[model samples]
Target: MISRGIQSNKVNGTFYPTSFILVGIPGLEGAYKWVGAIVCLCYVLALLGNMILVTVISASSGLHKPMFIFLSMLASNDALLSTSIAPQMLLVFWFQKRYIHFESCILQMFFLYSFTSFESGLLFGMSFDRYFAICQPLRYGSIMTNTIIVKLVIFLLLRAVTLFSPCIIFIRRFPAFRSNIVNHSYCEHMTIVKLAAADIRISSALGVAEAFMILGVDLLFILVSYCAIFHAVFSLPSKDARLKTFNTCIPHMCVFLSFHGLAFFTCLSHRYGGKRIPPFVHIILADTYLLVPPMLNPIIYGVKTKLIREKVWKALHKCQSPHVK
Candidate 1:
């Protein structure tokens, strides 16, 4: 019988731990060094790429529209999300330093979830921006102003913190932990919950609810926005014109698919893939899902967007010029 948080006779009345050990990538002992190096490279690229995107969006006068602003926001969020997990995972992999303080674990989990929620909010905002730009081009400027962007940023922050704070509080109430072994690469709400020796149904429910409330709602809106956009695109007279309009959405669509697809898989696997799958697979998937999107998003946008590509080319040329050397 699975002890649903019931304290066993093996321990005292109540127990609290100072730290938890992350048992990262269980079977890949010697190979973890190589894996760690690869993950570190991905982290570096994600940071560099996102930073470039943000800098370009900020400095380039042509890219100063609402769509680009939201793109920069997404890039910033991606950088943060990658930072929350990748560095620690590398530390664990390269040095075998897997033990993390309880408070630190809580902080990592908090920011990871919060950043993910905030990303969803930004994606929703971007979808709206795209919808207006393509579906109602005439009113796009009037509808999505700097004031609106500011209000959306505030809402994203509030929504993430408000929805996830109670989860941390509930986690704090767990009377004891049965184990100090976290089975994944990084700290997450469900991963921590499994270690508890108290009933965690409420926490579990809240975690699921949080995902549905944020990601689900954002997905719905994105789909609806795209539906309207597609309807409008199909009605356009020329194939060239339709393709030109859709070209703008291509990068965002790629990002949306990768981010949401990986996120949903991780969420489902965490909740349901308990006994059926090996722990190593789960760890690999979780780590991959988180790192891939951040690394991929900027590259996708750089390749797809003409203005950004031109800016990048000019910057590269400037750097390579003989006078600068």
Candidate 2:
């Protein structure tokens, strides 16, 4: 089976490998079925939740504003991010179908990194929307117009493709690959790049640079936006008004904290936690960064945002109601 699956690239009368194996969640082989089941459930829930968010936002005319637009885009990003990894992960866990074509792996890595960067960009855009709404209310309408929102979305997609494409190029050109066995559930950039047989200094450097450049900038923007927002809210004379304004930001703050917080710890544990922590712990943390945010975003918004909550409740009620004769 392994010999049959080995793909070859023809160049100068020589054949080279064009496939790789994904070692999904090493250790705990006994619990593969259970883990697969849980991963499947999370993937299904993420899809359903994000789909609901997108449908409600698109169908409801009242939700055509900047915030909901960004939310819908975010939901789309979450869905894409989860889809790129989850099904393959499930296959690996349940069927032991770990051999992935080299080209396919590269494509997966591209989408994964692109969606993550785009999500971060969307968060920054949402923060900007909130900043203008709360901190500069008088100019909010003028500055945060539909045109600006559209432009921001366009800019985000373009930036994601442009920034992450180079990582793919770098990986493709790398001279040697030490092993085909990838020690993670998904085709992550660093994980795949780390398998090269040659000095992968350039690829490693690029990965770190992309992380700090994109994620760092987004984090700084979110912080500055929220700081300015809090300042403006606190200065308001009416206590009720201050509370009312602050409530709008709670859901975004929750999402930002959960997503970035998981991401930070995952990176830390992978880099420095060393052999002190079990390999399973690292796998779980890495998967959490990909899975948790997608699953949690809709819940956060549905519970906190009045319009979305009402829309969802109404939809659920409609589904539950018996058909008229």
Candidate 3:
């Protein structure tokens, strides 16, 4: 089951949100709101931050180029990622009931997968952007245009949808089980897949294949992008310019590593050493990967893009300016 209509699927074999403690904490009511609150806040921030990015891209005449267009797409994925998980998580946490219908759970799973895949692809795209800028400075302007960016966005969307279609096929194989307990607040893909009463060899294979495909391809592309970037940086005329480029990349790389890298770590831990790991530890790491990055993305971009701060002050000054007589 996915994430969509879990509340509606409370009865029958569809899916239900039963009252249960979240995975991170000991029990349901005593101390989970803190986690829920943080998650919800991140979602809110992501939504607003993305909107601001979209607005800035739209408003600024100077920013109406290919790079900002791609940034807008990445922001869109970030918004989707936050929206898919945060609202339901907040509702369940506050009300003490976390029943989710099977169909709804499946829908949610689809979105979660789709947005994340799209994000990874977008990061790969950004790496390409940087590569072109650094490596082929003269050609960068011609290579990235509005038409090309739009086409790339469409391609990424279609690819994400196509790649995740197998997840649905695999999910349908599970027979209805009596127990409806979901170890997590929102039906995480791995959490539900682990509970399948039926043989999930196919699903397992698909999951692994998807993981490797997305992670492997994206990493390869990113590596190529950075390799080109390194060449350019090394060939730069000044040491200060090289330092500047690396400094610009540091935050994005940290965020990139933290999000996908943590997922890779958790998958490995579960595969070879999960038996020894405590549930709380598992939950904390999983939640960290989910909740932390959305909050940080805006901060990273805002700091990296000085224009955002300048625009903010400019707007504030305009707002405080004296009214016309």
Give the C-alpha miss distance for residue 90 in model 2, angstroms: 0.4
The CA-based lDDT of model 3 is what?
A: 0.71
**Cα lDDT listed for each candidate:** 0.85, 0.83, 0.71
| TM-score of model 3 vs. true structure | 0.87
**What's the CA RMSD of model 2 in angstroms?**
3.1
Model 3 per-residue lDDT tens digits across residues 1-325: 4543224443455443332223334344476777677777778888888877777767777766666777777776788888888787787776665666667778888998888788888888888887888788799989877677778878888888888788776765565443456677666666676665567667766776787788668877887778778777888889999898988777777877787787676556655566697656676676677667776776786548777667656766878999888
Name model 1 segments beyond 4 Å from true: 1-10
Q: What tens-digit string does per-residue lDDT give for candidate 2 at 167-286?
A: 899889876665677888888777777777567777767776777777778888998999999888889999999887778777678788777777666555655577898878888888
| TM-score for all models, in order of appearance | 0.93, 0.91, 0.87
- Cα shift from native, residue 192, model 3 (Å): 1.1
* Segments in model 3 whose C-alpha atoms lie over 4 Å from true places: 1-29
The predicted structure with the larger TM-score, 1 or 2, is 1
- List CA RMSD, all candidates: 3.8, 3.1, 4.2
Off by over 4 Å in 2: 1-16, 245-247, 265-277, 322-325
